[model samples]
Target chain A: MAHTSNYILGVYDDEDVLLKAIKNVREGGVKIHEVYSPFPVHGIDDVLGYKRSRLTIVAFLFGLLGTSLALTMQFGMMTIDWPMIIGGKDYAPVPSFIPVTFELTVLLASFGMVGTFMIISNLKPWGKAKLFDKRITDDKHIMAIDLGNNQLEESAIDKLLKDSGASEVNKKTL
Target chain B: MIAESAIREPLVTGGKTVHDVTEDISGRVEQKPTKTWMLAMAVSLATLAVGGYAVMRLVWDGIGMWGLNKTVGWAWDITNFVWWVGIGHAGTLISAILLLFRQRWRMSINRAAEAMTIFAVICAAMFPVLHMGRPWLGFYWALPLPNTFGSLWVNFNSPLLWDVFAISTYFSVSLVFWYIGLIPDFATIRDRATNKISAAVYGALSFGWDGAAKTWSRYETVALILAGLATPLVLSVHTIVSFDFATSVIPGWHTTIFPPYFVAGAIFSGFAMVLTLLIITRRVYKLEDYITLQHIELMNIVIIITGSIVGIAYITEFFIAWYSGVEAEQYAFINRATGPYAWAYWSMMTCNVISPQLFWRKKIRTNIAATFVISIIVNIGMWFERFVIIVTSLHRDFLPSSWAMFYPKWADVGVYIFTFGLFFTLFFAFAKFFPVINMAEVKSIVKATGEKKQA
Candidate 1:
């Protein structure tokens, strides 16, 4: 609710129009802070030229860590730490270790990827979201341009947004 | 963009715009409790109270309150355990597997189904812990924690211990997956919240989602990877659960086919449970347009496939038991069909194998009332399936003198009722406080697979 920065937000009703407007606004040499939508507008990232997310790499690394930890824990306990003959099987039964290993791998990978995603995306429980328009979470899509980031005059940027099919353009200090 | 097939039926039937989708889905959450919801909660809470008393008796008076004899030491407890666990599979299958396959129909049902998966697993976990009699100690002992008593670690080689890991991992991971999916939809509710308390609670739950394009891009990637991870996790969960029996020396329990057979049965029962709940939910909530008849038919088809697989597994088990020429194994299958538990076996056959086959008829599968009835029947049959496998196999062991018939005590029935009450209670609360459908996902697909264009 505290106002700190000046901004102009173009409100769009259709996803197709929003996609085109993102392109138009960017081509008009205005820097876009972000585009917000109720749902994931397919190809909006491509139009915005956002790079593909590398969370998968983080997941893979976490999975490897889980695998090794599970192996080491089991092997250390069952084989070296306090070996006891169970069901007359080998003290270190590798095959028997697969189920727990797989479970841990999945557990860590999901938790890791999600944790990394929240940290990077600023989606934290205590964080405050800058709400330019509540309708963005309903039916509207929003293209927010920070006046400080763009070199274009405020009137010229508003004209570009109108020409690009934004239903309305509004300015706010927030 | 890939064009949708011309012949494909529309997934969302109502000509709903984005605003309408949000309103229709979140409308329930924002409203005061309906009379039906109150009545349902009262019934659920009453059941939970009665069951809770029985659980306290069992916990206080020991597991001897149940009719678990020496021979049938694992009767209702294990049967219910496997039954509930199997019932937990369909949610992940719908959300994770169907997503990987690009099945758009799951969009409407996955949220509720995943919710069911978590609740069913909770019910399932209750049995084993309660069956331990001293669950307070058993719970900690089950984990591979370093103990003061000689620093003894849990048996890594035991399937039961593997089960400890599997169930815990499955529960936590499913919860995370469900919560992550709920965040965006929570933001929808949060933004629309008019009351201060409602706004604050939902806002916290939403984690302040801004719906930026880059975040959505990452969100999609994380969802896909989680789906990929969950697919195998679902399959592995049931496989390990089967290992609890398959690794045993019991003639009827030890079979190579148990893994695939149990997995199929899990999906089979899980979908039936989903249908049962959704049919009622859609009726009460009036979400029929989103959960169309087509969704019911498609799920019924899945029931058919998995049900057929389970039927074949039954036949294969008998064939292998006879072909193995082992007297104990042969006697196990014969005793299941012709012995004291023949009633249970045939009920399983009639309900699970024969009943789902009826779905082959288009008329029966498409009828909501029929689907509802059969869905209940399938669940009953599935419960009996586990009963047949566990009690029948254990009752008449090789030592005839030690063999005894297993009978349920009031406590057994009461404890089972407790889970039913608990499941419904949790479900009703979830249906009320949460948006029962994934509004965000449904919105993404509405324009593409909707029966009519946005108004």
Candidate 2:
């Protein structure tokens, strides 16, 4: 197991500057356990080589579940239980089911996306965020890259950060 | 040579800093009440008093206080519902759709539109939730539970139930979307807040943001995902709303054209509502630097597209009704043209279809006053559009036995009036309290736009 407060290499600048350093670190065959940033740097996912996300597939499946629930509710209500004809229509009206089903489909898809997203991002309520520096949200852009310090030495990361535009570098334990 | 070429525009105006963004937004919150604020408070309060009293009476009494009856059970209430829901469309459309399209001009007005969406939805929900004879038990109709006592399940096939789900989901999602966008800006405010109480309140809502790349990234990711989800719902929501009438076997109401038509109408009116708010709020808040004429022009373009869509839908409705040789449908359209509600029908055409065409003129589109007026006109037209559709369609249905004149009793008009009053009251409060601009996003855009100018 990795040490709780083991040394992690962090870089800070603007997004464009940090993105290049992240690419270089990965290209040097360094395995990154995670990257923490204040904002999403577009196109960084490609550099990280993360695969296309499964959120959409999850959303589609939730939509199917919604469709199933919508159908069963209408079918079971109209046909089997308390069948009553209002407005001189048939007992099992199909077209009328479209609206609710559509609503449920949307609701389920949205809920699924948010739930899966929260899981993947590892965001929890009221936990202290690991801070390299507090100005990360301001003009300063930063990258917190978890270098496998159980294998690599702290000196190598210090050199790597100084080589990049890291105005301030720190050792953080994940 | 390359360096000289690149040094065109500055990223920020010289000496402008993060404090400026906070100060500019919080100006309304901190400053003593100006004459305009006083005037607005007076107007909003008046509107609220009238509207609140109207709603109080509506709630105290049952739905029978309205002009609805056995045949045309949903008249003014439905008109209010559709109009308010339609009004909400532009916010999501402007914010999410424009973000996806990478239209940087959207920065000016997106936040206000979102506020409007939330408020307008609040108004829209009022009629349906409390419109029932037993307003308390109406909750039973909405909750998807096993009904032990009623001995019958709530009809899942109902568009009413669909509406319950749709409106609630729309309200919740829009709030989430709006609040998430404001978080970074709220933090910016929290840091700069004058008092400890203000700082604590703003700080807590800001989720302890430190603008690290991860927070912004995840925030954007959440926003983008929500936007992606919301865009289709913008279309789907109105489509389902249309289904509320269309799913019925009522001759004039039953048609496939409604989904697309309602979607178009919703967007058209939604843009109008946005235009109206942006014009007033821009001037009121002195957001001239942020809400430029260019942003208004882009919104006007959307308005124009949706207006044409509505016009085409109107024509298409007639064509389909006539071409299909459905006698009831034909009579319904004809009656709409030469009916008791003919004035409303014509007004809808004139306001919704004709007035929006002014945007084709560059001068008119850019002029804030003209844009504002036209927005008000579109709003009026859109409300009548619902009225003309609902009243005209039902007042002369297939059976003459069921035909009757539909008019809002005093109480019905009050419900409409008060609901709008509630909406404006909410909006006025929002304007007073919150930073109407998503300051961080605007700063980013301001930076990006400046870069392009330099390039």
Q: For candidate 1, write residues B1-455 as lDDT tens digits.
A: 12477688988887888889999999999999999999999999999999999999999999999999989989998899999999999999999999999998999999999999999999999999998899988845798788756678988888999999999999999999999999999999999999999999999999989888888999999999999999999999999999998999998998999999999999999999999999999999999989999999999999999999999999999999999999999999999999989999999999999999999999999999999999999999999999999999899977999999999999999999999999999999999999999999998877777788555
Candidate 2 lDDT, tens digit per residue, B293-366? 77778789888999999998888888999999988888888888888888989999999889999899999998
**CA lDDT, every prediction?**
0.93, 0.74
TM-score of each: 0.98, 0.85
Candidate 2 lDDT at B358 equals 87
Worst window of 10 by summed lDDT in candidate 1 chain B: B1-10
Model 2: residue B193 alpha-carbon error in angstroms? 4.1
Model 1 Cα lDDT, one tens digit per residue, A1-174: 454778999999888888888888888888999899888888888889998899999999999999999999999989999998888889889899999999999999999999999999999887677788998888888898999887889999999999999999999787
Index of the highest-DockQ prediction: 1
Backbone-clash count (model 1): 0
TM-score for chain B considered on its own, for each of the candidates: 0.98, 0.93
RMSD of each: 1.4, 4.5
Instruction: Tell the DockQ for candidate 1.
Output: 0.78
